[model samples]
Target: EGDFVIMGTDGLFDNLGEDAIAARILQAYNMMRIDGKVARAVCSWASQALLNDAFNTSLSKTAITPFSIAASEELDLAYSGGKMDDISVLVGMVEHQVQA
Candidate 1:
């Protein structure tokens, strides 16, 4: 019975305002509903949107910055250095039931 789903980046939860995230979610929901796509597809789209937004607004251009290919290394270093901020998520929904 569900119409839409959401997949989001950690940045949206950590840095962006809730109102903004809500608005985006609503927008994505409407889009998915209109297109008749499944919740998992919608979620994938939404997650990419969140990451794209973050990449666009990031201030650091260093090749080894946290948002770059070095993200994994940076995360490891942060863990060792006692920086405990970690965020990763995935969301999906089933739009129809399958018959056995």
Candidate 2:
């Protein structure tokens, strides 16, 4: 199966759960397929979207704080209420095995 594998740091996981991540990735994948998108483009879009979504979610007042009170306090001065942490996202689309 040529499935897409998304790896990210705690910063991302704390803001977005597996289902949220998967849904976004799947939506991106479908859009790419429809537009005949290349792997690099897909990966780039997925990475950027993941990062943005996490950042935005962290900033939302309704969202539960992903960081500890101390951590949130430290970050609040910088991010102004957003969770602060290093966020790294890598998306790998596995190659499909083609039968001869």
Candidate 3:
């Protein structure tokens, strides 16, 4: 069993295939696990990275834009909107059993 995680930009998710989002999330989870990170942490990291990237990247022609604040607000709104769009997440766990 593997964790299926989905991380997406709102633009793509709002306009395109939902299944593609699911597939990409699962793919990301798998890749993260392969890279030696746990599912939950991976998800958190992904979200943080996405937010950071979005904040650093400009979204409009305005030269003085608060990208990070805007991105944070957008994410909050999306979660509240209940539109069921693709969001970033991590899945699964790895256990190293120890002898009792």
Best by lDDT: 2
- lDDT score for residue 3 of model 2: 82
lDDT of 2 at 79: 32
User: TM-score: which candidate is best?
Assistant: 2
What is the RMSD of candidate 3?
10.5
Off by over 4 Å in 3: 1-31, 59-100
lDDT of 2 by residue, 8-52 (tens): 998888777677788889977887889988877888899899999
Count clashing residue pairs in model 2: 0
Per-model TM values vs. the true structure? 0.50, 0.72, 0.33
> Per-residue lDDT for 1-100 in model 3, tens only?
4534444466333332444334545655776758876667766655554444333332333322233335447777422111223433333334456799
For model 2, the stretches where C-alpha displacement exceeds 4 angstroms are 64-82, 97-100
Give the C-alpha lDDT of model 3.
0.44
For all candidates, what are the clash counts? 0, 0, 3
lDDT, model 1, position 84? 22
lDDT-based ranking, best first?
Answer: 2, 1, 3
lDDT, residue 42, candidate 3: 65
- What are the per-residue Cα lDDT tens digits for candidate 1 across 20-88? 555666767887879986666777777666555444434334323233334456566431111123434
Q: Which residue pairs in candidate 1 collide? A: none
Query: C-alpha displacement of 8 in model 1, angstroms?
Result: 6.1
Where does model 1 exceed 4 Å of error?
1-10, 60-89, 94-100
